[model samples]
Target chain A: MADFNASDLTCLRGERLVFGGLSFAAKSGDAIMLRGRNGAGKSSLLRVMAGLLAPRSGALCWNGENIADDRAAHQSRLQYLGHQDAIKPVLSVRDNLRLWGQLRGVSQLDAVIDAALHALDIHHLARITGRYLSSGQKRRTALARILIGQSDLWLLDEPTVGLDRESCAELSQLIADFRATGGIVIYSTHIDLDVKNPNILDLDDFAIPMVEWLTEHADLNDDTNDSANMQHSVSPQEAVQ
Target chain B: MSGFMAVLQRDLRLALRQGADSVMVVAFFIVTTTLFPFGVGPEANILARIASGVIWVSALLAAMLSLERIFQADFEDGTLELLALSPVSMEMLVLGKVLAHWLTTGLPLIIAAPLMAVMLNMDQSGFVTLMIAMLLGTPALSLIGAIGAALILGARRGGVLVSLLVLPLYIPILIFGAGAVEAAQLGMSATEHLQIMGAILLLTLAATPFATAHAVRLAIE
Candidate 1:
């Protein structure tokens, strides 16, 4: 069964501490919902899990192997849908899907693209340019890429964003079906997703030691006489503004 | 290999659907070449003398026009991230797109150069040399341009930035390309210039893609 594990992870974006000392695991037929307010680093955490961004300190493993050791092999069994649609406007819908399948080494690319388009309800627009599609249509086309190959793990960041109710419901069912087939899904969203026994990881619970450290350092600097001199060196009118 | 073919096919399909873009690029090449004669006062001697350099420069600019779109669309749509995440090395992906770019833009210019040469009053030998020079040089332009494209993926004024960054790197190609036609025009063997252009193409083919891939990764980050 497909599974992913993250251990003692710490991530930082410049001086801001997004999350630290966090750990999570997702297994076959399991769905993980990462919930947090904006700027809580939900997306950053997702990127780390996807191996797109490296954590300052941690280990991400797939199955029983360290993902870093066999990155290509681990990546092959996974599909990630990020915040953007990632469609090429100049390309027709069918050609886009065909390329995705072919790149992943999926056999019978035409059949795979056809199946994906049919599933996404965009079969009629297969020959249309991506630039001409609506926002929702573009999102569906991006979703079609996930359906092209047989990936065991799916990392979807706001997959339902910009989708209509019907489309959202369709996507929910698709994720459900994938889980039922023993595929692993880790998705992040602000809205509630109606799924059974969902495991929730709230980023708010993760501590940001880096932020505290920066604040403390600033406080120490403020107590020094040089700090007053530096602040005073600025013209009064300039400082006031 | 399948990964390479997939990228090649995807880019080619995109170019084909755009329909007028490739044609327009070739048209730009011809129109720009034609402008030099009128601008320089319809002197056949002057036209013949400057034909090689004029054609090479025009071809360079036309090829640059399309390079920005090569990775910009993919990067915006998140396909670049997926491609990077794919099992195929980013270098191979870059190479595939570069090959496709040459097929669409570079090949057409090479094919259309002869007609432009005729219009410019270029010598027959110079016309053949111009075609051969473009055939050798334009792929290097496309390959080197990929690095600029990837570097400026989400930057403000990316189109202008791509040209500014790439045009300087294109000088070696320009020198050899124009040199070949000039040698042929002067009744000297153009083989040395052709060899130089071919070497530049080989070096770019080996190095530029990795640099492009790195630039793309940084841009995405």
Candidate 2:
């Protein structure tokens, strides 16, 4: 019965309104493929969803209640992987997963770490410290942290940045298995990924029209205060344009 | 398994694995304090006269040495972002990391300060006072330094900027700390200075986590 939804969300990065009038919803077992060119706000939108960035105005809800009402509770239910794979350089791959597993309060932790390493096919590299990892191995280590059932929702900024084809296939299988267990995944990438019947969201369709937004805001308040109303009169439905 | 302990354990393990971070801090403490006696001439009177100041200043800088590492690696590799997404409040996570930094860096400086004092020809009467003041003061260094460390998380030349921002804030601890030992050396009651340093430690303990956590959250954004 769990659902993830965003309503009337607008994001501003510094003075630029990255995206405005954007809304999306997905339920358990859903996969959302967030597609866009660089700077199209795919990353910004994911960060906003994760509560890492405060959207200019929006409501993120879970099960019909505002997620902002209980930010910690909302965050505890999900995991996020950004472009930079969060591997600690000194800890071995196994220890990195163990640290996260313990933080998430996962019981049977040894088994979980073992299974996660196996899923990503990085089990043999578990004993080596992260500093020695190749680019693909580092990405695999980052992926293993998510495979351990620590959180049911995943917000991946670019999960496939350094993954090889075999590794990509393994990751896609992991995601599919997660969905089979009622997990929700929202991933952003420029390359095609092997996802099952994904709900596609191209961020270009939802960007703030910079020239129009500037003229409209300049008319309202000439200096410094124009950022507050940049999303005025834009409808989420109009984002389809 | 608790988030605080998990972070603390990881940081300490990393510190041990890296192995050289704590050694480098202690080495800096020893080397910097050693330079003073030679520069001021081995006259016990002059060395003793400046002993407290030299030790405090060196320890202060030594604490700054490892502050950059507090968030730098995690920030660079994006572990900090995952940490942000955890159920643990950023403030608690900051506290754990600060405690780990204290154990690795501040604790060693405390162990080394008294030895440096002896080498600098400090008065025997002031030795215990120096240890007490440092024990109280170093935690404040780690705590206050964490705020500076986090504020400069993504800035260019973060190491330099952390020292610039943190060194000024360290003045109060340095004053009260060095003042305590100097008072003891002069046969005066050092209790007031020691009490003030204790107060500063308490204040930083209560306040810096929130400030550091706010900075950490901003860096993540």
Q: Report per-candidate DockQ.
A: 0.68, 0.85
Per-residue lDDT of candidate 2, residues B107-131 (tens digit)? 9898988888888889999999999
Off by over 4 Å in 2: A218-241
The C-alpha local distance difference test score for the whole of candidate 1 amounts to: 0.85
Chain A TM per prediction? 0.86, 0.89
**Per-candidate count of clashing residue pairs (backbone under 3 Å):** 2, 0
Model 1: per-residue Cα lDDT over A120-239, one tens digit each = 899999999878999999999988889988889888999888888888888888899999999988899766666778899998888665534443456435657756664565558476
Per-residue lDDT over A1-241 for candidate 2, one digit per residue giving the tens place of the 0 to 100 score:
6799988898889888898889999999999999887899998999988889988888898889888889889888998888888887778899988877877788899899998888888889989998999999999898888876557789988899998888888878988988998999999976778999999998888887776666555554554545434444344435867
Pick by DockQ: which candidate is best? 2
Chain A TM-score for model 2, please?
0.89
In CAPRI terms, where does candidate 1 land? Answer: medium
Task: Summarize candidate 1's per-residue lDDT along B1-221 as a digit string, tens digits.
Answer: 88888898888888887878899999888888888977898988898888888989999999999897688878876788889888888888888898998999999999888888888888888887887888889999999999999999888998888899999999989998999999999999999999989999899888888899899878766
Per-model TM against the reference? 0.89, 0.93
